[model samples]
Target chain A: MSAHATTEHAYVPGEIAKPNTAWIWKTFWVLVIITAIEFAIAFALTSPDWRTFRNSIFIVLTILKAFFIVGEFMHLKHEVKSLIWTVLIPTSLLVWLVVALVTEGSFIGETLSHMFSS
Target chain B: MAHSTTLESSSTPIYADAPRTGTWDGGNEPFKASYGKLMMWFFLLSDAFTFGAFLTAYGMIRHKHGVFVGTADKFFFSTAHWPIPEKVFNGFPGLHGMDLPLAFVALMTMILIFSSVTMVLAVEAGHRMDKADVQKWLLWTILFGAMFLSSQAWEWSHFIGGSEKGLLMADGSVMHGANLATNEYGPPLFADLFFFITGFHGTHVFSGVCLLVWCFIATTNGTFEKRGHYEMVEKIGLYWHFVDLVWVFVFTFFYLV
Candidate 1:
């Protein structure tokens, strides 16, 4: 609060603010552990029948990693709520795009198979 | 005459003469961020869309090829099926014949995350206006970024060179390496998507390193110190972290999935 006041009237670059290094380390460990789990899944689950299930796990883990990297690392979690929503609301539309394209692509794949058989 | 001019100008002032209701008014920062930081967030939002489109296209193409309902041994290096990523990215430096899968990429991912940690530390130091601390952390960030780029280069070269046996095409021609034209691993589009997405991400990392260097120099020359804030470091830190964030998705979709 005082930092904001000082910045408004008489800015002080040498203002002794407490650094949040511990939070950085905690975030770092979280990211590392999540990545390790991903690697383990990639190697341990090798059955082709498990492809869909494995991919789902991978996607969930990736989103978790993204949450930490963006929220904590980028400081969005601490930013104003409006700014956070502004950034997130639009990107959420990508989920729709992914589903639409994947469905469309499967249709084309079926067409290719029919033509080849004919 | 002076009083008349003042009244004329004050008649339609751009900002209201009345006191602002709260911080949301034009008189204060509603978002609690500077204009530059807000613009950076918008820019990153746009950039995310570009990457989103690219990755979505990759998913489309991979699905079009159809998934193989067989063992990975049968799927590996099969031209009729989509190549398993672990099989394709199994090479490790200095280990000629080992079939180590996803190991090197795991290392690369750790390197990037470490660099991100350093970058955040730099920003934290900047908050305290500690010049030496900021510089130290920035240097480490830059070095780790370069290391990640170097690892990517090695991976790219390995991809371009293809495997020793190579794939025998339907036309009886053995394709040795991958280009935009054909791939020894799988469909031509597979290589194309790999090239475009990873290459685009590499370009971002390259530019991020350049930006970090600029920030380091500016810190050394007391630019942000003179400006009474190290907000520049924080700005570049955002970009660096975004790059790292994109890699998380790329690593999952491109390599693991």
Candidate 2:
């Protein structure tokens, strides 16, 4: 209501007063580049020694992609620090959950292997 | 004396200095955010946890199966019996005779990512208040989303129905498609996990598509124009991107890993 009088003469129906599209394009390109890297990692590394390394790289790349989507596309990147932390801080614990569960699950596999072989 | 005082207060008008009974006091905007967008953010945060738990369970079980070595059986699924993600996901669409591996899924991912890009453009248009532009970009986004959903359905059917030769596992057993019990892939657990994770993600894609359609109608039909704001476009854009974001992880953990 306060804005109604100030912009009465300049008001336009279909556009922001000033538009910026560069960031959207930049984000799109970044996602493409990361996905390309993912494909490269998928087929290029074939050795068992490389398996763990490759998987870690993929996880990192996946996180990077998520960052762009959340930060740029979702516009959280521009939001205030409180809004950003409200999101990122607690989700960090979820990452811990990933680490803990994988470790325990590996132990279960090892136990099963021992039981079956014996 | 207290009853008499209350009667006096009512008669004299306790709130006489202030106006009463109109609209809400709305509440604080700590981050200069709107109520709707903040709620959406919180909703997305809770959703992240749900997907996180599912992926964690996946990580746990697959780790137990052991890390993948080159051959299908040793780490993946040998007669030794552990599942390899790549082996199970190796099917290519239409080109049945050859194993194109992750090619088809990669294509699906591209479609989804591209759809996300289009959605961003639509929101951009909305920002400009360009109704025609918003409609055009939104239609494209909806198209891509629909394509993705249809392709997913085809992929699901092919997996469930399987191929004529069936999957020849490292165990020397031939299995067809997947079931709750077992499939040629690896263990019954592998089948269960695949169904659960992908199915959950697919449902989100389906919902996003529906949201896209609604947005398209609202954009073309002057809904936002009437309100004098395009925040709805921005809100749905948040959701569309989230769907794509989740798929990025799914593609990594389920297919790539």
Among all candidates shown, the one with the greatest lDDT: 1
> Could you give the TM-score of chain B for each candidate, in order?
0.90, 0.83
The per-residue C-alpha lDDT of model 2 at residue B130 equals: 77
* Best candidate, DockQ: 1
- Candidate 2 similarity to native, TM-score: 0.86
Q: Which whole-number lDDT from 0 to 100 does residue B148 have in model 1?
A: 97
CAPRI-style quality class for the chain A–B interface of candidate 1: medium
List TM-scores for all candidates, in order: 0.91, 0.86
Candidate 1 local lDDT, B109-208, one digit each (tens): 9999999999999998887788899999999999999999999999999999988889999899888769998989888988999999999999999999
The number of the candidate with the highest TM-score is 1
lDDT of 2 by residue, B12-78 (tens): 4444333222223222346767667888899989998999999999889877874444654344343
